[model samples]
Target: MVSKSRSEWSTILSHLVLAAVSLHAAVTSAQSSRGAAAGFLLQTFAAITMLVPGLNTHEDCLAGAWVATVIGLPLLAFDFHWVNGDRSSANLLLGGGMVLAVAGDHLGPEGCSVAGQAVLLVVSVTILIVAVFTANTYGIWGGAMLGVAGLLSRLEEDRLLLLPKEDVCRWALTAGSWAYCRALHTQRLQWE
Candidate 1:
């Protein structure tokens, strides 16, 4: 087995922290903006995070990243509408962005194998269906992403290994999504 060097692990972890910190700051900055635009900004950030780098790969990492955006982006939009002034239409924009973002991720993995692509397709469609029927998109997305991540980590079942690079990248996206969602939730508490 080819083992990962220590430097590679360090580099991966650093990127992970960078992803979390950068997005967390964006969320904090959005707090001051206090409007539907803030949600859109976060949605934009989510697009960059997954489709760009940090979690740049063609497997569960990409799947989980899309799942996170699908879940968190909508929450950010809803909070914008219900608390940050009266922009109900922004919620729809957010919902649309969430689905579009996930679809983008599913479609863009240039290196994923047929089997890997199959996994992502199955997972994304399941989450999309649930999101359509359920009110808690966040819960559904998060759970689905976590489930796919776990499947990626498993020893068998025709899967990819969670290499150190992939590990940090995946967790970083997940952590960033959580941080932003938490910030929006905190804002909700203040309004309440």
Candidate 2:
């Protein structure tokens, strides 16, 4: 029993490692096409493998994970299909989130004053709606890269830096970053 328990943990730990490594590679490669391609590939595999963990044991948490994945995954497949011009649901959650995030890409700390902040708040909240539904590495990685690029392009002392004026828009990216780190470090780290 003891060894069996250890083996199960080892399995879980392995998944965590792979998730982490993939996330790291994906995030680090955000600036280059080769990196982006590779990252996406890794993320694709990670999601596929993640789907099977619930089978090893039947627990409520695993069941919930499965349900969450099912609820969130179809849009990615659909989107990827459209991108390849194939029009299938192969990457559904990925597809839908991309559409939303791409549209919301413009809301950044730009000429933002009090009025601007109000507009940004509305936009960020809209973006967050899509972001919340995304549970995969693709959504997290994409958002992280977008946020990073947005921050760099804006390139200002006051705007780029998080400070007292911070609000949800300021930390809107925290979810993606948080998910990226956790996926890479905890789940993807162990992937073979």
Candidate 3:
């Protein structure tokens, strides 16, 4: 029991670290793209929510995290366009998907929330594919790491090396946010 408690504390610490990384990313990204910065800010909020006690066990907190992500991804995509000058209609699709996700989370049944998340995940992956095709190396890496984090989130009932899956998820999220910041910074440099 003591070991489990210690593990939980470690998980919380990991989430706190991710929150700090995300906040820093948001601040730095703000200089070149407010849209992307806002996305990172929302991500910071989502990470901070993981620090709340019984985060995984609490439905409300979990929903809050989902909602934040649902709202933030499009903003990130907006910045992706801003940096690359893609000017594609994909951003509209991203925004539409997120809006549906938010609506499902707030207005639909429980199953709707899950469906909404699935939609958002697909949208995120599509954006990542675009990043890869565009040769945005940092964006690709960041998207991959975040995808891993998302996958890990589904394995909350599992444990690895006696540590909760949440810890691994947090670490992945931290790395992803850092990579995204680098991506934004580098791309902004090229644009200027």
By TM-score, the best candidate is 3
**lDDT (10s digit) by residue, model 1, range 22-80:** 45645564645354235335434544554455555655455644543444444444543
Regions of candidate 2 where Cα sits further than 4 Å from its true position: 1-5, 21-60, 88-192
Candidate 3 Cα errors over 4 Å, as ranges: 1-4, 52-59, 88-90, 105-113, 116-120, 155-157
- lDDT for 162 in candidate 3 is 69
Predicted model with the maximum lDDT:
3
How do the residues 1-192 of candidate 3 rate in per-residue lDDT, one tens digit apiece?
Answer: 245577868777887887798799888888788987887888788777766666655666666566556667667767776556665644775567577655764565566546544644554575577668777788788778777777766653777556777687678778877887887787777667
Candidate 2 lDDT trough over 10 residues, lowest sum: 162-171
Q: How close is each model in CA RMSD to the real structure?
A: 14.0, 18.0, 3.4
How many Å off is the CA of 52 in candidate 3? 5.0
TM-score (C-alpha, index-matched) for candidate 3: 0.79
Q: Give, for candidate 1, the lowest lDDT window spanning 10 residues.
A: 111-120
Q: On a 0 to 100 scale, what is the lDDT of residue 151 in model 2?
A: 43
Regions of model 1 farther than 4 Å from truth: 1-3, 11-57, 101-107, 110-186
